[model samples]
Every structure is written in structure tokens, then in C-alpha cells.
Target: MKPICFLLLSTSAVFAADAPKPKPKPEFQYQTEGIQVSLPRADEPKVKAFGPETIKAAAKYLDDGAICWVREKTCVNCHTTGPYLSERPALARQLGMPLEEVLADFVKTVPAEVKPQKETEKDGIKYYGGSWTSIWRSIGLAEWDKHVTGKLSAHTERSLQEMLMRQSADGSFVSYGEVEIPHITTDFELTLQAARAVTAAPAWLSSLKDPELLARVEKMKAWLRNAPPKNDFDRILRLQLAYYMPELVPQPQRDAALSLLSSKQHADGGWCLRDMSALNDWHFKMSDTVVKLISGLPDAASPESDAYMTSFAIVLMRQNNVPVSDERIQRGLAWLKREQRVSGRWWMQSLYRGNYSYITYIATAQAMKALALCDELH
Candidate 1:
């Protein structure tokens, strides 16, 4: 009887040992002030880990890169420098540094690389030959005032003057409009950039005696209202522009756009960038001009619920006055906190190799900006 019992027990132990073990939870880590912070997966209860110090850590890493990128790279596109510039003011404050001190030195180096398309088009001095010089320059000018001193730098002032001079009689700041479609790019990025610029000046647009700039501003508002956004990024930017110029977006349109964006939020409370082929007929056709742009070749990682898009979604909702305590906003914020890595960067893969990581860089910077902004309201 003892021999049989021992044999049975031994066999049971062997079977138990052979059984598979459960997998560990997924995690993301980011180092802050030399301390690494790890975040649990969305499925886990720990996804709600929100921390301001992480923003500080991420900003330090990004600021160092911004300075380096400007010094090493002559061009200043949205993917590289614009995102950094956009966030530096908040970052400067978080770091407890003077605003102008954070910006003045770098601001001096950009004007040369940011010249208008032509040195000689007075009536409609457009700036769109290379995208880096045109729309991004306008974006930088808007962000520059958040930290820089005195009036808009002379070059930015001249650029603004040109942009204002060229405003369409009907009022969309569309100096160039090749890119548009089912909802990722914009037809009036230049217009959005212009609205951003004048808003930073605080009543500068309203103060103008000409009334032409003011009227065009109204027309641009109407264009956004009547035209409706077919692209995702444009929709996002339009939401942002509405924040700066509330009168431009009617309350009903505002509520509808917000609902549209919220509806697109994934089950995990995050956002994903889908392939152009995945869109509806009208959208796919609208996005057809650049099929290669959306095809990520597997490794490029299209249609992933990435930190970049997710961060923008959260920030937009928050900026639009969605309460931080709201479950949707909280879940989205949790998603942002959940996806960041221990390296003080979020992993955002590219769709194309040549220009791929630039988007990643932009994503990282924007992620940092979004988190930092969230911290402000909290």
C-alpha cells in the first residue's frame, strides 16, 4: 500500500510540473531623474499611473535632442523641430527655467533656414516649396511666443506679414493645398497655422484696423464650419484651432466633432492610425494620391494603437474642456501613461523608412507635450 501511494504521488507531482504557467503582465518603463518607472499593461489595473515627474524626465531628454537636431540639421520641419518648439514653454516652466532663456538662443539660428518660398513674391508671398520652411515656420512662430521675449522675431513678423497679405478673400489660409482626404492631413494647415500665430499675439488679429484680416479670420472660421473635415489630423487641428478661437466653431459643430473623435477611440481607450485601404470608398479614394504613405510593410507597423495618436486624442479632449475626472478622459490619460517606455520615450514606428523615424520623433515630442498639458490641468 505504501509503495502504491508513493508512486501515485510522484506521478501527480510530475504532471503538475509539466503544466504551463501563466504569462507575466506586459509593462512599459521610463527613467525619471535616474529612477526608472514601469507601467503595467492596459488590461491591468495599474494603467492609471499618472505622474508629472515623468513629463519632466521626458522633456529633459527631448530638449537635449531639440538643441542637437537644430545644431546638426539645417532644415526645421514639423517632425523634427516644430513639436519640440511647441512644447518647450511648458517644459521650460516645469524645469523652472526662464521662458526667454529657454528659447532665445535657439530662435536666433532658425530664421536663415526658414526663408519664404521666394525672396520676391510680394502680392502673395507663399512659403511652400519645402514643407519645412512654410507651414512649420508658421507653427514655430506661434509656439515661440510662449517662451521668447519681445514681439515676434523680425523674420517671423515678416512671415506673418506675408501670410496675412496673402489670405484668400474668402478667408482660408490655404497658401498650398495638395494634401487632403479621409481624415489625416489638412487642406488648410496654412490656415490653421495662421490662426495659431495670431492667437499667440493675444488680440493682435482683433486689433487690426484693416478689418480684412479680421474678416478673413471669420471666413476661415466659416470654411471650417461649412467645409467639414474629412481627414483625422485636420479634424484634430480644427479642434485645437477652435480652442484658440472659440467663436470660429459653433457649439453644435464642436459637440459633434468631439463625439466623432470619441467614437473612433478604441476599446482600450486609445487611438490607432489605420491604413488608407481600410477607409471607406470616399475616404480611400481621397487618400489614394499616396497609397505608399499608408502601407507600412509589416515592420513599419501601420494600424497600431500607438502612443502618439492616443496622446493627441487625450490632449484634444482635455484641451476642449473635457473634465479630467471624466472616465473617457481618464481612460485616455491612463492609456498615455500606460504606453510610455522606461527610456523616457514612447515607441512610434514609421510607415516609410526615409521619413519614418521623423514621425516617431514628432510622436515622442507630442506625447511629452500631451502629458505635460494634462499635468497642468490636474
Candidate 2:
């Protein structure tokens, strides 16, 4: 018989101290785009799993990651699993849907006569003008409306180059388009996603040497080298850049970043947001963001952190070709196996206000991807 111990985990721990907190946002800014971009602040009366007891909590909470205020919810609301309709395809994969279908369905929302300014907002505001359309164009679906392959492609490529060109005098890339101001904080996470896009764009771009593109890449590299010290997301960007362009970053800095990540594991086996007060903005759940951050840990024994974190460690280890046979990995895997619901899904906390899909898909996808490497490791 499988030993089953049922534990209901709350996503937060009870703060023994009394402090007035702010009201939770009804929805995040991306709601119009149909995505859950942020979570509630800690000032809310939501119950969450804190400490080692998290394994048994029922309602797990997560922190919202947005720095700016928006009119919509998180990414989940905007990008449904329908073909040709969703705005963000990376998010569609989280919903386990066909990317083309998702794009086809979401592009219908774009207004006609897309302009560069309309497509990309100035600050934190949502980009309404065919920005979604432009993203799809990169993936070969740019002409979903009228000119899928013609003017839109040229426009998108030009727009991206322009975005890359306007690097901060200090070398960091600026916001892509018009957006809400002082609202979106450009953190390590955003930079990492940007790097991934920059790294992959060349393969998708018709030509690799777009002069403009190479210059932007160089500037991006410079900004990364000069990024604010102690920013976790910046560390991630640096690590990724080191992986992509080894000669650009010194090897010593690479070791230092990984060492920093490995050493920062809290006693509770989680990474808190940069500012303790930042927790207040995280949607009522802290664990969600914590686990997501755990994905960047560089520790060899990270699997021993906790069940949730360990799961993330296993996923990362397999992804990086690191051995996963550590005793901690076995124990963590065993614990998760026992906790798997009859639906075969691992339920934890949602970082934003939405369905369980966000955290579930990310965690599961990592696990699934790692499991594929198990055969190879054996």
C-alpha cells in the first residue's frame, strides 16, 4: 500500500505581528490582454502556507510580479488555448494548447491599421496596436489579418531593431513601446525573457546580421555586464549570457553568480522577493513566486530545499545536464509522487488571481521536460 499523508498547505504563513496592509487588486493590468500578471498584496486576509507546513496547506498564495499598475489581469486571462487567437504563445504552452490556434484566436482582437507607436506602448501601459500581431509575425503568423507575411513582418523587424537601438546610455535596453510609466520595474525575470527572445530571434529572423540587431546585442551584453549587483534576475541574465556568449562575461563572475544563488537559500528553502515589503504586492501567495525563483538556483543539492523547491531543482538539473540521482532528488520525487492528485496534476499556489493552470503548467512542464532526460541519465 502507498503511504499517503494528506496535508493541506496554505500559501502563506501567519504574521504574528499586526500591521495594516493594502487592499488586494481586483485584477491585474493584463486582464484586458487576458492574462493574470500580478498577485494580491500581503495586506489581504488570505491564508497561506508558511514554513515547513506548506506541504499541507489548502489555499496556497503567490506574489504578483508586476511593478506597474495595469487595467487587466495576469497572462492566463489573455491567452486562451484557442488557435490563432491568443496574444502570447509562450503563455499558451502553459495552457497546453496549440500555439497556432492560440495566436489565431487572439489576433482577432487587434484593431486594423496597426502602427508602430500604437503596437508598442511608451511605458507600463498595455500595447494595443498589433503588438500581439507583431509577436505572431515573428513566429511566422504575422499576416493573420491582411498582410500576414508582407508589411507586418518588415514593421515588426524594424520595431524590434528600433527597440534594441534605444538602449539606455548605460547600455541597458529600454522599454519596447509605450507602456505605463514607473509601473513596470525591469527586473531580472523580464531581462531573462528578453534575452531568450533575443537569442532565439536570429533563428527566426531572415538574416542574422541585420547590423542593427548585432549592435543591440552588443549593447545588451554591455548593460548585462554593468547591471546592478545583487539583482537575482540580473544574475540569471548574466548566467544565460555566459552560456550563450562565453567570451563576453568573465568566468569568475559566472561562478560568483551561481555561488550567490546557491548560497541564498533561506532556512525555509525559499527565496524571498528582493524587498521584504515586495511581498505585500505579491498576490496573497508567496510560495508561487518563490518556486518560480527557485528555477534559477545553481545548487547541486537544491532538491533538498523542500517538496515544491525540490521539484523545481529536479527540473532544472535535468535541463542543465546535471545529475539528478542525489538522495534529495529521490526523496523529493517520492514526496511529489505521493502528493499527485487523481487528476495527475500537482496543485500548489497561484501567484496571480486565476485558475491553477499558471503554476501547474510551469511546474509540470519542468518536471515533464526533466523526466525525458531521466532515460538519458540512466
Candidate 3:
């Protein structure tokens, strides 16, 4: 009887060991318009040929994606709708796309109160939902006013005012701190976007009459001038800031930032986010197993050219006076043109914990912006 019991237990253990494991949950799952929707997994398909029709398909994809996000989430996010507003306005007038609806959606995000109540705290800092939203709304509205209407709307002013109200005493704004890379991760990126917002609207800044608002702007400028960049990502942001607000970044520093960015371009004429900073530098808190599972590729320790970085690098270089005729700019643009997926979106692997890769949305937006700046999208 004892031998039979031992043999049965051993058989059970062997069966358990051989059982197939359950699959992991997808990184992104949500409902859109009363229907369950899961974002497609990120992948790099073979490049499609670029032509006039390519731009049209890309435009349709951008418009559909932005409107869908706004209707479903009804909130400003760093990944998709925010970047769509920031970059799409420039192309809308040229492409004859309808942007008023999307623009209105962003303006509605601004709170009516001058100083909204903080809703949460992270690492000892107070955070408001509007902290991140206001800055992005300001940027989006500023872009719309600059490129589309050529006049700042009252809502744009209100959004900027709300953004200013959320500013930290040190001249930076609080970020989501969700560890979402490239944006919503750090105070520096938020501050840089705030700078871009205000500088992009010179008329709004000059028209400011409120003494408190003026002082807040001064504090922000001082912080921008004093805050040191922690990595190459920050440096590229600084180069972008110099384009809009030259006073915050010295000419020599601006030149050095550009040189550093130029040096990081891959042989394929693209840039890799991994090359911008070490994994530790990003300050993520996920475990190794989770990282490997979500990334589902080679470790991020090695550099691989991606759409977000490539389009971002090209846009910043052009903004800072790099000519489209330059070989580096040409190659980078060529890479972008070659990499458009069949869905008309440029694919970028998300550096965040999820597989949503909504970063691809921004990547596509920036890709279009880069092409427009190079006179390829007209």
C-alpha cells in the first residue's frame, strides 16, 4: 500500500510539470464605443513604397486614430491624442482634413478654476490630473493657433493659464510619473513641453497682464535656464527648446546638443531610444520577467532604430536649422518614407510596461510632421 501511494504521487507531480502554462494577458485591452477592443501587437513589417497615395492613407489613419481615442478615452494622453493635436494641425490645412472637432475636444480638458485641487501624490509631490493634461492641451492649442487659425483662441489662453497654475515653485510641472518613456515620465520633459507651449505663442506671452502669471513665466524660464539635462533625451529636448525659446539655451549649448544628436544617428539613418539613455537612467521599476515579456524582443540594452526616435530626431534637426538637403537629414527622411506600415502608421516599440505601443501613434504624427517640414507631404 505504501509503494502504490508513492508511485501515484510521483505520477501526479510529473503530470503537473508537463501541463501547458496559461498565456499572459495582452498588454492593452479596453472598450471603445461599447465594443471590446485590443490594440494590435507592435511589429515591423516590410516597408511599403512611398507615393502621393501614401500621404493620403497616412492622413486617414491619423484622423481615425485621434478621433477614436478622444471618443473612447475622453482624456488627454501622452501617447496618441496629445501628439495628434500637437502635430496634426500643421498638416490639416494643407491636407484639407477636419480638425475643429478634435481641437475642441482638447480645449475642453482645461479646468475652469485657476488652481484646481490636487487629486493624488507621488514620491512626496502633489499631482493633479490637470498637471499633465494642461501642459499637453496648451501645446496642442498653441500649435493649432500657430499653424491653423493664426490667432490664439480664448480656450488656448485659458489652457495656458491652467498650465501655469500647476507649475511647481522650482519652475517645473509635475508629471504623471507612470514611467512612460519619452513623455509622462519625468519633470524635465513636462517642463520642456511647457516651454514649447509658451514660446510657441509669443502673442499670448506678451499680452499677459497678470502679475502672478508674469512671475510664474519668469520662474519657468529661470528653471529652464538652470535645470541640467540628465541624458541624451533631455539634450534633444533642449535643442528643440532652443528653436522656440532661444534665450533659455545658450548658443554654444544649443550647438553641442545638435552635435550630440547628430552623432547618435544609426547607419540606417534612424535613431534608437535605447541609445538615448541606459535602462537605469530611465528610472523604470518593473521586474526583469515583466520587461522581457512585454518587450518580447532582444533586450533594450542594444540599439535598434525605431520610428518615434527617427521622426523625432528629424523634426528637431529641421527645427534647429538642419537643412533637408543635408545627407543625414535625407537618409533619415528616406528611412521614414520606407518604413510606413500597410496600415499607414509608423511602428515604434513601446518602452513602457504595456504592449499598447501607442507610441506608434505619436511616431506616425511626428513622421508626418517631418515629411511636411521637408516639403515631402505637400
Candidate 4:
């Protein structure tokens, strides 16, 4: 009876000890709102022909160009062309071919989406800048196409040739707009990107053999050399063009343009596009310094620039071989994560412009690309 009682008491104690503890709460889980990216491993297929030096130089040039725009508080200018040029090498490797084929794919696929905006403010506002559609088409989706083959035809030559055509003796591109544009504005960044696309498609250019187009390209190159680096956007444009057309512009000018941009980098690592326009003009009492001082806007907690600008600046910096560990980079990332819409998208409200799909795509693609670039650099 004593042995039985002891066995029963021991069994009971063992059962109590074996009871499972409550499951610990999970610290991290799958992010439904984050971008779903399964990019191919970079180390699997070894890169050929291009050396680390080339990559480093290209990265530095791109970083300089991007910093220029950030310093100015605008993501236009060099940023317009930055993604195209910066993405070209990676896109080339992704397709396992030369950059020209990717450029051709861009030329073929992008124009279909460029139909004139028939309905405005219905689905979303679509703003028009000369060659803006062309710029967007040339970069975003076209870089991924691997099926493009063959060279430019005589008919295609006309379109490619028009890119170099000078609207005036001065280096600035002429406006199809009724405003009689005299200087390059932030709106023209898309056109700058489109022009870089033409330059990238070397095979197409070689096949076209249009003397007029070649001459015009040379003229634009010459014009950009002396082009004043007034704003961050202008400096970016000049530097981006110089990156591709090194033969046209001297290294000194390029260095100078880059230097101007580096000077503008803010202490927080983010850039501002602070518009100094009179508040009275827009019927507001706030001054430019006050409005430009914040990250996004009054309600936002980070910098004044929109998510689109912040993401783009990050992409540019990563492309130029800048470490993603920079304070500005981290702040920008934090801001991006916070800005994610419930639908897994991000929106950037420009101070003076309406919202649209273009900014949305730019912000999304740029944020994804920045994350990818940072991964590679690390």
C-alpha cells in the first residue's frame, strides 16, 4: 500500500512537470505589405568582362549625380536618367547580354502606354512633360525584357534621331508645350532619362547611321558642358549626361557638377525639394523656409521630401557604391516603411503637383531597387 501510494504521487508530479508552457509570442512574421521580391542570387552566375573597378567608378559617378539632386531637394534632373543608367548594368547582367538589347526592349514596349491623357483627374491625374512618357517607358519595365533582338530600322531611326534634335542653338531641349520653355525645369527630367535610353541602345544607333542625329547628340553634349549648375536638378542632369557621354564633356566639368551636389547633402542624410515660391502666390501664409524645413509635410514625422524622392535618392546612392549604412539611408528607409499604404503601395504628395501613377511606380521601383542594391553592396 505504501509503495502504491509513493508510485501514484511520483506519477502525478511527473505529469505536472510535463505540462507545456504557453507558446512564446512571435517577434517577427511575414510582412503582407512589403514588396514580394525573389531576385536571383548574385553570386551564382559569375559576372564576366566587367571588373570591380568599372563597377566602382560607375557607382561613384551615379552617387555624385544623385547627391546633387538631393542637395537641391528635387529628385528630377540626374534622377530622371539615374535609374536608367544605373539600372543598365544590373539589367544587362539579368538578361545575360549587352545594354543595347535592353534599350531596344525599352523602345519597343514603352510607347504603347504613352497615349495622350484623354481623361484627367478621373482615375488619377496624369501630368505632361515633354518626353516624360518616353522617359518612364525607357526605364521601368523595359530593362527586364530579354527577348529584344536585331537593330534599328530606317523608320525607327527617325524616332531615335529626334532625341538629339536641338530645339534651339542653346543646349536646352525645345518644348512641345505652349509655354515656350527657355530653361530646363524639374518637369524635363523624364526627357533626360529618355535621351539616356537612346544613348544606351548603341546597336540601334550604329545601325541607324543618321548623320543629323549624331551631330545633334554631339551638340547637346557640347551644350551640357557649359550648362550652369544652378539647381540640384540641373546639376544632376548635367552629371548624368556626362556619365554616359564622357567623350563629349571633360572630366573637370563633371567633377565640378558632382562637387556642387555633394555640397547640398543635409545633416539628416535626406534631401529637400524646398520650393521658395511665395506663399501668397499659392494663397498660403507659410514661408518657403518653413515649408521646406520638414521632411514630407506637417503631418509627416520624417524629412520633407516625399517617399518617391527619398527612395530615389537611396537608389542613386546605392548605385554609386555608397554604403546603405549611412544615416540618411537608414532614415529614408524608416520613412519608406512608415509611408507604406495599406494596399502595399506608397504615395508621395508633391508640394505643387497633383498625385499620379508615375510617381507611384517611381517610388515603388526605386524602393525595391534600393533594397536590392544595398543587399549587393553589403
Question: Which runs of model 2 end up more than 4 angstroms from their true locations?
Answer: 1-99, 103-186, 202-206, 264-312, 315-320, 326-339, 354-357, 373-378
lDDT of 3 by residue, 1-378 (tens): 555655656777878867997668654333456444345455646446887777887787677777777777788877777888888877875677456778878877766766644556666766565677778888988988888888988888888888887888788777654566777655677888998898676399888899988999999889878887767787778888888778778888888988899899999989887688755555434446435643566654565898888988888989988898999899999898888977677877767755566777778888888898899976
**Per-residue lDDT of candidate 4, residues 55-157 (tens digit):** 4433433333333323332332222233543354453433233334324434443233223322122223233333443444433332323123333333234
Lowest-sum lDDT 10-residue window in model 3: 28-37
Q: All candidates' lDDT scores?
A: 0.56, 0.37, 0.77, 0.42
Best by lDDT: 3
lDDT of 4: 0.42
Q: What tens digits encode model 1's per-residue C-alpha lDDT throughout 1-378?
A: 555655666777878867997555433222324343343222323223445655555665566556555544545555556666656655555655423432444445344542333422333543334432444555565566545443555555544555555555456544332232211244455566667766675335656665655665677677756665645555556677778778777677678768877877777877765522243322322333345655534533535576777777777787898877778777777777777655455666543332224455566677766766667423
Deviation from native of the Cα of residue 319 in model 1, angstroms:
1.7
* Number of the top-ranking candidate, with TM-score as the measure: 3
Residue 170 lDDT in candidate 3: 81
Clashes (backbone N, CA, C under 3 Å), per candidate, total: 10, 79, 0, 11
